[model samples]
Target chain A: MRDILTIEAVEKKATRDGFGQGFHEVAQSNSDVVGLCADLVGSLKMQAFIKEFPERFFQVGIAEANMMGIAAGLAIGGKIPYACTFANFATGRVYDQIRQSIAYSHKNVKICASHAGVTLGEDGATHQILEDIGLMKMLPGFTVINPCDAQQTREAAIAIADHDGPCYLRFGRPGWPMFTETGSFKIGKAIQFSEGSDVSIFATGHLMWHAVEASKKLVQEGITVDLYNFHTIKPLDEEAILESIAKTGCVVTAEEHQRNGGLGDSVAQTIIRHNPVPMEYVAVNDSFGESGKPAQLLTKYGLGIDDVYAAAKRALTRK
Target chain B: MADIAELKRIASQVRRDIIRQVHAVSSGHPGGSLGCTDFMVALYFAVMNHQQSFNMDGANEDVFFLSNGHISPLWYSVLARSGYFPVKELSTFRKLDSRLQGHPATHEGLPGVRVASGSLGQGISVAIGVALSKKLKGDTQTVFVLTGDGELQEGQIWEAALYAPHNKVDNLVVTVDWNGQQIDGANDDVLSLGDLEAKWIAFGWDVMHMNGNDMEEVVNVLNEAKDKTGNGKPICILMKTEMGMGVDFMTGTHAWHGKAPNDELAEKALGQLEETLGDY
Candidate 1:
């Protein structure tokens, strides 16, 4: 673990930038690695990979369905295709395409989605996709990954290509906390931020930074908190979750997604089946987001750092 | 050649298997499966140059995808008889824990099935992807996809149609089973696909029409498709096949779209088509 930064310092770096940097780095090593964009190259920060691997990159224009098919086809020809598009377009618009051409075919395709959740900031309900995790996870053999920050997103982009099956890597557009140090990322391994006995805070994607901040706040208020970043949602680190729950009697899940089928529900389901534990979810409570600043939306939707802190306290009180 | 007659005999056996498999399960789309039997038999046996051992990557051999997967009975029979799997596995059609799923899927690890296709109008897009993969790898093998006329109503099919031409996907041969009838009624009744041939031609594809029930016509049109490959345009074969070709009672009827035959009906169907090869 590197130096734990203050919330202000961590908030300076964007996760999409990490994705862009990592994408370009991976393209340098692997010639067969290709990038496909559905007219969202600049927004998703995939222009770096496009610039680095011009011949290998494919600009599919606004046709997301065609982009998915082409990416699947590229995978069939021994090419590792990273398909970049907004979260709304990647999962919701072209779900049938991903289901049949990529997941069902078991193609080695990476669906790297950016601008996930209300954190997309002022893009409104049409751009924000709170149901992407549920949609991607329901697909059999599709690996779903939501990295914490820029560092984790970069690591996930480089690591997902080595994975043989279809993957949905969800990241956000706005700049968030960057806690992880620059290094290689391991998929399906829960990174523990703080070890405590009262309650476990399992967070994913941009919400991990908030969870860490909440954990620090809880510690000062005489509460011992355990925080874990669940980067991979599909092949979830069940052992890590079970181990944390065994130590802490209760759990609190945090994510910038819908409360129904996002990280909270996934963790709750696992805990109930494997190790029954009292759990609370800190997420947008089954509502579509509105146009606003990302920070304001997070606070309004009960997904801010304060919500995670409250959920941790409530979960701890449950035991 | 003697093989041509032998292949026809084998096709008869495959048709018997299709009827038997559908009848045994008491549920399956037999009309289209029976109608496309000769074309499938000719494709797997005479047309595609593949390896004895099946590989999903299909880097060195021709690849085929059944987009309208309701005809899995015919494809499974052809694959089993063609040595992709055991003939005995045909009995487990639609049964629990069987590789022969209601739709063709790779989930059960069934050989020769590259993707899942119970969902209509997704196979051509997948086939295009596979075709694109072949192009990227410098693999000279062609990809063949078969879709139903009714399935062409899906928007994704048009999405794929517009894409194949724009991308110069010349190694793909998409065949539409223009048999007119679907589950509800004729394709014209369900949803009129106005000028389907003209639609493909306008989409910048090299289009050809053939009688799919006739093995010779299928072979000729497919050969023409092969010759037309690598010409900067995808090939579309609008195969005009009957709803049911072999059995007189089931012919030109939408009632048999998914209805299995009773013992008497099965006997009558068997009477029309000879079991040239041994039944499973």
Candidate 2:
């Protein structure tokens, strides 16, 4: 297994690229695996799958709701379908399609959502949907995942195919630092990058890299904080969360999403029910994002390493 | 065999079940349920060659989706009579802790229901998805979906319509129950779906129209649709049906769209249709 960091060396690669690659790889091994895109072949990085398996790739053309229906139909005939589109269009735009056709029916379909959160820079508020996680996670029998990096996204693509029922795999457009090694991915398992009993930071997607950076800075200051990468948001590893909280007594959750229903809210709900712990949420504060570079938006919206650092400090004070 | 007579007998039995089920619950749509009885009976009994038992995967068997799921009384009746589940369960429609809810849902782990579809205009999409899946699996078995004419106003139906023909989903046979009435009033009165057949044909579907209440035509047209499959295009059959059939008081009116027949009205309705298949 190649290390995950080496896979990340190819800079400027969108997380969607990982999905496209994994899709092509799965198609080669399992002829039953097929790809569908809603006129976003180029945007969702599904061109590679389309080019490789022209017979298996379907271009539904600018209709997300229809694409979802088509994908569900494909699943009924025993084909594993990965429906690709932007995060906003995939979840919010066609939520009813997913709910009735896929989730309600328990269809084995993968909803691969690209350009998730504010990282889809320059598209502005209309394209930037910070509530997709909430929309998808709330559905019964729906598994929600936000891979930390490109390599993890690729593994998630293959892993989700093997699992039955509906799933929403969210990834971002902007490429960040890749920290995990290739082929070392596990679903629904939180990876602890750093360990400390003082405060635990649970983060996902692009925010995972930011949490890592903050951990390094905090380590220098002699504050040993436990850092966990929560790639799978739904079917969350509750045991891991409670174990960490039992040790830390205080927790900080981070994601590039709205504070209301994203990873922060999920963690808060779980912590309150299981373990009563002091926590701080590092997310886009009940607001929308505008057109800007991905890095600038992260900083401007208080989702950068600085925010994670501040949140860690706040969580420690609560402890 | 006289297809119309056989279908009418089956439909009469289904109608009795529909009224009995709704009357037992005191809530459920009987207007559309009764209206589409002839269509459902002809399709299940004479049209599709499905297995005796229901299978979710449906690998080698023909599949059917009730897109206008508000007509679950009719569907549940036909499925039970067709041996998908126990006929005794028919009395549990829309009751507390029953497998049958107001809208059809798979949450109860019902054998025949593949998807939950009370929210209008979603079943056609799911049926299309299942048809696509069947093609991918190399299964030649066809998928049939039934929707209401009023339900066509939903934008998602058009979205799925555009997708089906573009992808050459030839295994799908979509039927629109043109009852001409919705919950409020006539479909034209609510939101005019001008020239529905023309719209489907223009969307690249192989369009056909038939009198849905006539069981012989329903079966023959459906057979024609099955034979027309694998021709690189999806098939759509526009079925012109009465809002209520068999029951004299309910027929030819939208007033019974969802109104359950009371003890007096139920007696009147049941008098027109004899219980040939035995009431649940």
- What TM-score do all the candidates reach, one by one? 0.95, 0.96
lDDT of 1 by residue, A1-319 (tens): 4322343444567778888888898888887788988777888787777776677777777878878877877776678989999999999999988888789778899999999999998979899999999999999898999998888898898998788889999999887767675563688888877778888999998888898888888888878777788999988889989999999989999998998888888898898899898899998887999999999999999998989988887887789
Q: For each candidate, what is the lDDT? A: 0.86, 0.86
lDDT for each residue of candidate 2 in A215-240, tens digit (9 for 90 to 100): 77787888877778899999898888
The residue-by-residue lDDT of candidate 1 on B145-192, one tens digit each, is 999998998887888898889889899999999999999998888999
Off by over 4 Å in 2: A1-12, B1-3
Question: What TM-scores result for chain A when each predicted structure is judged separately against the true chain A?
Answer: 0.96, 0.95
Which CAPRI level is candidate 1? medium
Candidate 2 chain B weakest ten by summed lDDT: B1-10
In candidate 2, position A287 carries an lDDT of 96
Q: Could you report the DockQ of all the candidates, in the order they appear?
A: 0.53, 0.69
- Each candidate's number of clashing pairs is 1, 12
- Give the alpha carbon lDDT tens digit for every residue of B63-140 in model 2: 898888899999999988888889999988888899887888888888888877877888777787778677666789
